[model samples]
Target chain A: MKSRKSLGDSEELKEINISPLIDMVFILLIFFIVTTVFVEEPGVEVQKPKAASIKDLEKNSILIAITAKGEIVFGGGQIGIGGIRPTVRRLCAQEKLPVILQVDESAPGALVVRAIDEAKLGKARAVFISANPI
Target chain B: MAIKRNFASSEDMTEINISPLIDMVFILLIFFIVTTVFVEEDGMEVSRPEPSAVQTMEKDSINFELRGTQVLMNGKNIGLGAVRAQVSRLIQGQDLPVIITVGEEASAGLLVRVIDESRLAGAKNVSLAGS
Candidate 1:
């Protein structure tokens, strides 16, 4: 009888209280949810030019990329020059967000100018060119 | 009697299972972790002149012509390294507007670097013009 009682107590003890673990997980989950900003990234990588005047831009702004082939890209897809105005207009409709142009070192200058013109026409709060700190 | 007591105890300890809730929470946590982008983008602002604000070019305004990969001033290739020096030498303690006329074949990177160099040289009102 004593052995059976001991066995029953051990079984009860084996059921570890997991409330603390759930609490920790809940905290972490809430933290991530609160801090998440769903900004679309320009998927392709480009070699950004180095500059001494580069400053930290807004993290929640729109990101557009110009490849070495002069292809205008946004959100992992080639949007072309025509897409800039519409995209910027739609995104900035709710709130005026800055537009950041990530141009490769070898991208053509004409495309950059056109892209800026379109973004300006779309009412971007400001247009910035991404660069590395020299 | 002991078996009856054990059965009664088991019946009395009815707790709601929360394993499913924990699983859902874990999935949400993982999703957020994977989606979070901690990218720190650094950049310089390009202040394009408004189309309605077009005015005659101010005299003594510094002009930089970007052609292919070369920087030019007055039809002479001042080269990339000489941009800051040239702008500062011409600026001479005034808020001289610097206009960059980007050529068709000029690279975007070189143009941005020239703008940055001009800014560093204390040229305040920098603007872009299409070539």
Candidate 2:
């Protein structure tokens, strides 16, 4: 942030008013904070994959937890391929359920893919694999 | 005395004006917004437990232990053809809250896929369990 001053007049120099600018900043900060809604992943604890280049998402929907030992759970509850569609449908109907798959480092790809497939089948619009930022 | 015209020039103003400060503030806001990183959690955790529990897998689940000719479902040894047939019928209309247990072993060949295929065959829920 840069500023300039008006000189040459000792008695009445023109000064730049900054109170409005500061006010604007505060408004924007508040707007971003208020508009952003945080979402928590459900089910068991999931250790996310690490990536050097990961971007932040503003909002997310449903969450799936994958343990390093290869156990998959969701919504604080465990379900299998048989139980996926109904749960997914229930979640998606409320909202488009932007799914995030939090996979453990040791978890295999086949399981992750299956979850994604189920979410899609349940009518979820988008599915993102959770990864830690670098 | 002429006062030497005072040494200060119009361009030599020492005090800074703050209009440009607003521009700088906006620039910073844009930078932060563009650089911020956000993340979403993965869906769920499905793990294979150690084999020692007395609890049994779901009666309707197509539990398979693939050791070439040693295919099993629901704790019974069966042929591949029969296993497939059972899976196709088991995952019909059920969804959510149901479970399909898969065993965990470094050498549990085809068990993972069998679990996946069972899901594809129509199982609503799939999980890995200790057999």
> For residues A12-33, what per-residue lDDT tens digits would candidate 1 score against the true structure?
6758889999999999999999
lDDT, residue A3, model 2: 30
lDDT (10s digit) by residue, model 2, range B8-86: 4534777657668768777767765654436443222233322332144444344555443355655677754564467
Minimal lDDT window, size 10, model 1 chain A: A7-16
RMSD of each: 6.3, 14.4
Among the numbered candidates, top TM-score falls to 1
lDDT of 2: 0.55
lDDT of 2 by residue, A26-122 (tens): 6786565555555544656555555432345436576667676666677667776557678779877867766666667557555555666677778
Interface RMSD of each: 1.2, 9.2
